[model samples]
Target: MTTANNANNNLSPWQPGQSGNPSGRPKGTRDLIGYVLETTDGGKELIDALLFIVRGVTPNVVVQKGTRPRKGQQVRPADQLKAIEMLLDRGFGRSPQQLDIAHNVSSRPLEHLSDEMLKLLVESARQLKEGIGGGYW
Candidate 1:
């Protein structure tokens, strides 16, 4: 007869889409956790993880998506660097030594962040700061 070890070898680790609930969260648990998990609050943990990883590779830089500036609304590279420094200071509660770190790990700068992208990043950072013991939010 097949044993549990045999079953274990055959089955892959849990995946959300494999089931109705991809997070291995039980069915209907999504109904309850969905609001929280799908929300800024719920997703803050993941967002923070991503940001932390980016911060780890470089001290004073943040990686973000690239986008074109809106008409009549321009952001210069210097200002973008300043904004990144400000965001890092606010989120980490520490002073940044430089406005922007050279692409030590990535080729892009934060200025390339789009309005929507920046909005989400700021919101995520804000939510995480507030949710955690960090008081910068």
Candidate 2:
């Protein structure tokens, strides 16, 4: 029986300007993984593991409590390449990709074109649609 306005009003307890969480996530609050990496030995271990992978060596890191230790296996060339890429990306940010885009299409407003130009444009479009002339489209 509640109207749309009443439904919206009940959705939020705070007033318009008031924030639901006034003191948004404590300034130094970090996620578990980030905290472990920053404060504990995990960060160094992670870098070491990445280096080991790059070098085709199986790192002696425990996965589960009861599982048998992993035997040294030849790391795939693709995997080693990926590890190298990850390390480079983390150490010195990912390389910027260069994109070459060539735009040849005209985007002039219809009103800006002369009557004769507009007619020619329409004829060209009609020809293109009918498979008469060579066009990119």
Candidate 3:
């Protein structure tokens, strides 16, 4: 039977501590998102667009070089809802999810458990994580 070290060695072509690509991603090439959100005004523009949608306001757009800004159609309800969700998600972290676990076993220190008990505890924890059983022994 192949050990973990042997399996890893078989999978990887390069030696340990050696990078697969010596010349990695080019230097001075910033991520597109970083460039848009940090370096440019795109982030502010995005926030403004979201706010406009949430407020049901029509965004203004310039038609020509000298022409006055024209009012676009009112933001759709679906789009407004999506924009509100996005703004809320960005402004505050996502809401917490509540799990309905029904475990009967109270928490105990690992050092107090025997080897067999430890194995059972580990299996019980796994079952709880997978939402398999209602309670653990």
Who wins the TM-score comparison? 2
Provide the global lDDT of candidate 1 against the true structure.
0.57
For candidate 1, the per-residue lDDT at 132 reads: 50
Stretches > 4 Å off in candidate 1: 1-107, 132-137
Question: lDDT values of the candidates?
Answer: 0.57, 0.79, 0.74
Instruction: Tell me the tens digit of each residue's lDDT in model 2 across 1-137.
Output: 56988888789576889988888988766786688787548698888888988999877766587664468667788989999999999999987665454854466667988999999989998886885664435
**Once all C-alphas are superposed, what RMSD does model 3 give against the true structure?**
9.5
Over 4 Å off, model 2? 1-31, 38-42, 105-137
RMSD to true structure for each model, in Å: 23.7, 11.4, 9.5
Candidate 3, residues 49-111: lDDT per residue as tens digits?
778778998555333777743466657899899989999888896755556758755576678
Candidate scoring better on lDDT of 2 and 3: 2
Model 1 TM-score, 2 decimals: 0.20
lDDT of 1 at 42: 72
Model 3 Cα displacement at 96 (Å)? 1.5
- The better-scoring model by lDDT among 1 and 3 is 3
TM-scores vs. true structure, each candidate:
0.20, 0.50, 0.45
